[model samples]
Target: MIYAVGDIHGYADQLDRALALIEADGGPDAEIVFLGDFVDRGPDSKGVLDRLVRGQAESRNWRFVLGNHDRMFLRFVTEGQQHDDRIKSGLSWMNPRLGGTTTLRSYGVGGPDSPAFQPPRGKVVETLVSWWTNQGNLSDQEVIIAAREAVPDAHLNFLATLPLWHETDDLLFVHAGIRPGIPLEEQEEDDLIWIRDGWLEDDRDHGKLVVHGHTALDTPEHHGNRVNLDGGAGYGNRLVPAAFDAGEVFTLWPEGRRPLVPA
Candidate 1:
């Protein structure tokens, strides 16, 4: 059996439980695929990622697809000051409003920054950092610089290596939905990781059954052509992990399985 888990969003406890549920449901040999956003907006982004890094080292069957937040996190850490608005944004990843503060806290970074500290509104991350410093929020600015150092080397490498999507004979697993009508192989990376635009509205088949997260729902949604398994875990609720037997879907747990539509 193949199992694909939805956005984990840094809740290590839920992640552990979800893994246990998968193990109980499919035993040791099941192929596990994780759709990302594995960091930000939760208590333990580092803890959640550390577990995945270890899982990858131990199991060749484990696969991961990067999410938008994960992309932002990577840019914040690795890309440094180089900013193109096309690929980078204005320190949104470091702002608490976008859940970056919670993610940084997981790594033992980001102290009590000034409540009033706001970077100059700009399109470049370099400008944001510079503005923070200019505003005399020196402590917050220094923490931003050092937080990248706080991330473990293994964790950084793991995040850097995550794929945009994973595909099987009949299913395309991605962090977010693919753009409708576009050839799957030719779809833009941004659309795969961040799209909600017309992709969510159009019901036209995109060749393969797209299984995804990013757009959260109260429950796993079966929209015929797609399955949305993001249970809003980042917003603090159950982490919805799912299993697919051939192409049928199920919500999995230790006690039992709830067959999701057409199963």
Candidate 2:
């Protein structure tokens, strides 16, 4: 059986709970797919990344699709700038408004009084160092430095190799929803990463169940033959995970938030 989940958005605790439920229902034999947005807008983005990286390394059946946030992470790593021309042109002020600013701050990237003053490149290195030393579990400082220096090329290669989309027998996964009118081959990455209302409203078939996360819906809303599992997890909203074959759904809310029915 296959189990698909939506945007984790750095909620490692919630993710753990959801995965526990999945395991209780079915063991490691079950195939699991995550719809991306694995980082940002939470206190533990580093932890989330570590978990996913470990999972991918160890598991053959697990799949992870690229999200807009993940793309931003790559851009930040390569371009050394938070705002990409393509992203900004596509949606003005959308990236920064959606807790991107906060996420950058968490990485020690942008602030008025930040030490990243003269050379922004220094800031990138500092951010990486901070993430490595503080967030990573390297026992020795020298080991961490050696690891960073040795794996520079590997890191870039891995980020660049992330798949923008993934298709399976039961579901089609993307960061955001796809364009309704255009063929999948002709669809733009921006639309797949940023579209909301139109794709959700259109009823056209996309050959398989299009499971996506990007639109921060209040609930696990379903429309246009697609399942939107974003659930606004990063914006103090509930973390929702939808399982495909088992027909199960799990919602992990903040301390006082109201709960949704399981499955």
153-194 per-residue lDDT for model 2 (tens digits): 543454567776788775688888898867778888788777
In model 2, the Cα lDDT at residue 38 comes to 74
Among all windows of ten consecutive residues in candidate 2, which has the lowest summed lDDT?
124-133
User: After aligning candidate 1 to the native by TM-score, how far in Å is the CA of 5 from where it should be?
Assistant: 1.0
- lDDT (tens digit, per residue) of candidate 1 on 1-263: 68888888889999998888888898876799899899988889999999999889887579899998888787777765323243344545556656776787788765445123344555235333422323245454465567667888898889889989999888889999988877877999889998888888878777888899999887778788888889888888799788888667889866789889832
Report the error of model 1 at residue 223, Å. Answer: 0.6
As a TM-score, model 2 comes out at 0.70
- In model 1, the worst 10-residue window by lDDT is 126-135
Look at candidate 1 and give me any clashing residue pairs: none
Alpha-carbon shift of residue 36 in model 1 (angstroms): 0.9
| TM-score of every candidate | 0.87, 0.70
